[model samples]
Target: MKICFITLGDIKSIATMKRALGMANPLQALGWDVSIIALDSEENRSRISIECNENVQVHYYKDCSAKEEVAIKTRLVNQICPDFIYFCSFSFRNRIIKSKLKHKPKILIEHSELASSIPDNKGPKKIALRLLEYYSVYYADGLLCASRYLEREYHKMARQLMKKRLPILYSPYAFNNDVIDAARILQQELNERYKNNTVLLYMGTMTRNYGLFTMLQAVEQVTKQKPDIKLLLLGRGRHLEEAKTYVQQHGLEPYVEFKGYTPENELSSYFDRADAFISPLNDTVQDWARCPSKIYMYIPFRKPIFTSKIGEPKEIFGDDGHYFNTNQPDTLSKLIAALADGRLQKTDVNIDEHSWDQRAVDFTNWISAQYAVRFAAAGSEVFS
Candidate 1:
């Protein structure tokens, strides 16, 4: 069998990109041919490389502008006629591909809580997007939800629609152990500088909805009582300036360090040095549909985690680490300081179940099953 995997970014970096890459490798290992199509740019093509020896090939098309990007994607779909096309997010490209393909299987994976992920809108743009979303969800052969929560939400919204037959697959984010081990060694070196201080690391994109502003305030509160605590924020986003402002306002400048836009290659080293990982994401309708990608990264380090009661993290951990109410700085401060408590140190958050390799293995089986069922349904003519 041949699978043509498609997405909008580099297959080696973004969470969805890496997951697609993971999907490609195992399928190839099982003796299937695989090809990946991404937003083919000169910069991305030059920087990224697929590791598979021969079974897999990566085709990059130069998309000069946003308009050109769509043109290139259309061209790739026409060229690579594989058994199935697995893609992330919904767009004009997916719709065009589905309409054009004669007998190809296509899976449209929802990476976020769609209705909630969009910003608060009032203009014509909001109205247009709402309509676009309705069609995108209705037309796909299969709808893959990143978590069970999203699947439930999807069903609730489209219960009356005929699209119920679309298979809802859970596509969780994953962590490669080899990557974790390498990151641990690098983290050890970084930790040497803050040996006397307890380093609290916050990984992933720093955004307003991420509750970094509130988390920063809580850090300020914690530092006032325990001056030995320090914070290292390791990602960049639109709200970075706001996070800096929170630090300044709370006089946390002395204790907090802003390490912006750390590459995925260098992330593990930062994770290694962190005495504890904190993601006090705020509770919003958006967060309720979110699947925290950071949790997969932090669990393998075997250090305790600090998070809010939002979406899948609470269910996944279930008292394995520390949990706090969202937006409550006093409670958050207590949770951060509580990590140093002797009892919390020994609380083992079981990460073996959450490993990327395991997730990939499960996904591999699921993909195979999807193929088998569809192929069987299509009868001898389609398989041949």
Candidate 2:
């Protein structure tokens, strides 16, 4: 079987790229030809490095303008004629690609919370984009969701468009084991620097939606009892400066370290040194359906987790760690107190269910089966 992935972002270090590559690796191992065609941007082009693996080819179609992008994509589809095309993140380019390729089975995968994430986005431009998103989702041959909550929202939206059901599949975000190893190395190095303090690591982009400020607040509260609580924050974002200022003003310079944006290959060591992974996500409408990919990385270390009860976190990490009230610094402080006393269980969450290799194998098998059924029904010759 031949599978081609169509993605929204430049196929670089983003979770979209990671998950696609994770899925592709297993399919390729099983004798399937997998290729990724990404919308190349200067930002991603400069950073993306994918060594050509056997049975897998990564292609980037570079067109700065949207019109040129569509043309480039159309040409690639015509040339490749892949049996299956998985679209990650809805786009106008997908409409063009679907129209140009009459026979290819297109699958749309949504990773974020779409509907309630756009309540105030009711202007003409927002409405137009939502309509496009809705249409692409409703018309796809198959729909894949990263979270069950998001799947429920997707079903509700599809029903509004007279679509009762979509051939929906579940695919959560995941990391390559190689990347996990790198995080372990970084963790050891950070462990040496912070000496005695337990490093509470938070990876991924630091932003308002991700609850970075609340983490800082939790740090301030925890320091009084557990002065040895050191925070190692990775990744950069719009809210980095604000978080920095908060750390400085609260006299947390000795306790908090902002190790901004490490490369993908050099992250596992950090995961190794982490005593706990913290994500204080709130119960906003946006947070309800979203699944942050960081939890997957945090789990492989088997370190205890500290997070708010939002989205799939509760379902995935139930009783494995401590859960705090979103936006409540007091509750976070209480959790920290319990942590110092070894009250929270350090047991591993059952991430065997969320393993990247398992997820990839399942998805590839289902895709192959679906394609076989379609081919047989259409009276096409099947290959042994």
Candidate 3:
């Protein structure tokens, strides 16, 4: 089967992009033809040119008027004539694309609810965007939610919007087998770099809602008592400058290191050096809907994780992971101290079931079943 994956965001070193590639790679291995369509920002184009293999066909479009962009997408859809189109998020463009297609199945892969994710977004614009996103979900033939929380929420939303139920699948973020193998080889090198210090790693965009400030505050307190503790912050975002300013103001330069925007393929080397991983997400609807992509990466390293006790993390990690309240920096400090003193125990959960390959197979099966049910209900001939 031929599948087309579409995204309006940059495809370079982003979690969503990596997830798209992960799904595509496994499908390709299973003898399915896969192609990617992404917005043509310079950053995305450069990354695609360097990282994507020759076998993977990629089409990029420069910034254009909304009408023109939709036209371009319609043309591409006509040309590819894919059996299915998997979009990375809900957008007006995607809604139009879904309207244009008659026989092809369109799937929305929701990663976040934009209105809540961007704390700064307010007023009528936010409300309008939220409605657009909800309509996008309503128009899609199916949904591939990143977390079970999202699966339930979007399923309900879609049912309410369409006045009927639509097929919804749970396709959480996961690790690729090749990436895991490569990371294992760099373990010794990473260990030698932080010889005596208790290294704690965080790999994601720097944002306020993600609790970068809270993490810095906790690290400050932890280092006061345990000066041997070190934190390596990876990835870049809108809050990078603000985070740096906070670090400077708090005199945390010695304790915190900002390693900006490491390539997704090279992240395991950084993950290998860390004794523990941390996610300090604030309590918000956006966060509740999110399934941190980094957790899948952290799991294979066999290190302890510290995260907020809410949403998907609470459901997936449960007692196996260390939980903390987002408002309590002292609690985080204590958790860090526990890790530094060799008191915390690592979770012994098997993660092979969540591998990208297995996820791809499951996704494929789910799609097939949905198509079969639809076809049978309509009393029409199946595609193949």
lDDT of 2 by residue, 60-176 (tens): 876557777777766776777777777666666543455777566555565555542645566786778667767866668777788878778777877887776566676777656
> Candidate 3: what lDDT?
0.75
How would you encode candidate 3's per-residue C-alpha lDDT over 1-384 as one tens digit per residue? 667887676655434676666777677766566788878887776655544567777887777877787788777877787777777765666434556665665554555444544567778778877777677665677778887777787777777786456788888888777666664555677778788889988888788767787789899999988999889998888999999999999899989999897765567677777889998767787788787877887777788889987777777777667977778888899999999888987677678877888887788678768775222321232455
Better of 1 and 3 by TM-score: 3
Question: Which regions of candidate 2 fall more than 4 Å away from where they truly are?
Answer: 11-14, 39-52, 93-95, 115-122, 182-188, 368-384
Please, what are the lDDT tens digits per residue for candidate 1 over residues 145-218?
76767878676556656666566677666666655655354655676788888888987777866777767878
Ranking by lDDT: 3, 2, 1
| Per-prediction TM-score | 0.86, 0.88, 0.88
Indicate the residue-level lDDT of 58 in model 1: 80
Worst 10 residues of 2 by lDDT: 372-381
